[model samples]
Target: MSQSRILVTGGSGRLGQMVLDQLLHAGVSGIITTTRTPDKLGAYASLGVDLRHADLNDPQTLSKAFQGADRLLLISTDDLFSGRRVQQHTNAIDAAKRAGVRHIHYTSMPEPEASTAIPFSSDHVATEATIRESDLSYTILRVAWYAENPVELGLIPAALRTGTWLTSAGAGRIAYVTRSDVARAAAAALVRDKETSQIYDITGPHAMSAAELAAALSRSVDRPIEVRQVDDTALARELVASGVSPQLAPMLVTTDANTRAGNFERVSHAVQELTGVPPTSFESFLVKNKARLLGATDK
Candidate 1:
């Protein structure tokens, strides 16, 4: 165990895998990645990438995972609204400090400062505050909305099925960030010669309204689409009814409220400076994923 090792939690996730790939592409040495299920990451293991099953929820597992790592990347768990998730982060932070990890990089939301409406942001802000007060050096990447988030999970599927992108973001403008940019920025921070222990707001190139984004998607997919505002309360209820868990409803509601309040609009230069490339444009995303996105329509 040496101080040169870098440990990345959530290493098997889409964004984490991208970070791992970029790191391997750079031939950076001493990278360690942890997953809840190591078997699924056999591809990475085959490439001689260090993989371990270390669930942050377990204190003992987290302690072992944090061992010998000079820097840690806490990619924030996806358990959207559980208090236990926040507690899991607290455990990781505690374990990292105890292990004498020099630095930590945490992925957070766009405007944590203005995201009081969102329960998720509160957790993010609390964890960030804890990091600042702790002796261990820390860097927080408050990322903007992922361009892929909308297309992959939130809107595109529904838009394709119903010809409308329904959301609560009434007139809010969003600067769509990309997961690849987040990954690249993370890799830079992990391998940089100098430590960056401050908060960096990573964002995409342009800001657009929900209507504008829907128009862009329609143009890309060659289909007619409309952006419609949905009731946040009803959406929450539907999510709960559809087995999204009652605990998560508030988080979704708060997030949509934040969106409606225009908290996702801020732009920043951190991505370009950190990754040595500008964040991908929304149009670029459509171009790259058009085939997959429009496959259903084409068939």
Candidate 2:
């Protein structure tokens, strides 16, 4: 059989870059990647990845970018809380079908069909349904929360400053995996020859509650932190007061609701199964990024 030509969308983004690197490390050639700003991906172009300009919102660019691709990685966009994201995803899927892409791998959130508590779940659910209804073979990778997201989201710093982390997700457990692990899994799925449609819930090894997460942060930063439970409305109000975008506050608030409902508590070995390595743990991630988390200039 001929080798597959892989096309990865959003190749300059965090997760997409990692996936591209892993595919290269696995010795897979004929790789293609798409980005709106191709100049930003000079490193990838140097590595022989066919870097093409494609915008999910612009269907005109997708078909050409997807040409000759045996598999396509439809990395979901980061435009949360906007209704346009779903439409953009649908456009990509339609274009991939038109381009004769055989298999499509999509990065999606866990239990999108059942996790109504998360405002963005409907978008992923809709996208997944579209991929399923199409003629292409598909792999649905339902990713868990990123272990580093708490620091990036300002949750850890907020807990450090206030000595309390207010949350609506009371006693909710999350199996937070890393973006690197998810990317590796995506690369593995792309290289493997799977004849049938598949769905994998890629997650960390274990689940922990908000209190546990706070304790882990405290240990990493060497500062005391506390978890304070609050209602969704209160959390949303606090987030807005803290300068979070008013449009995004509600979605964050509902994420807590979803967590509290155990929607994110599932732990899976999909990462290990796919990449042959266990996913990174939350504590290890915190320890590795302690300096950055503590506001230090260097590690």
The top-ranked prediction according to TM-score is 2
Clashing pairs in 1: none
Clash pairs, candidate 2, are: none
Residue 46, candidate 2: Cα error in Å is: 1.1
Q: Candidate 2: where is the Cα deviation over 4 Å?
A: 239-251, 296-299
Residues 1-299, candidate 1: write the lDDT tens digits: 12367888899899889889988887777788988988888998878778877888788887777777888899989886567777878888998998888898899887786888866677887888888877788889888878876544434654676786666767878888888998998888778766657888888888888788888888887889877677887766654553344754555456567878989788888888987889888978987898877774343
lDDT of 1: 0.79
lDDT of 2 at 209: 91
lDDT of each: 0.79, 0.86
Residue 70 CA displacement from its true place in model 2, Å: 0.1
TM-score of each: 0.87, 0.93
Model 1, backbone clash pairs (residues 3+ apart or across chains), number: 0
Worst 10 residues of 1 by lDDT: 239-248
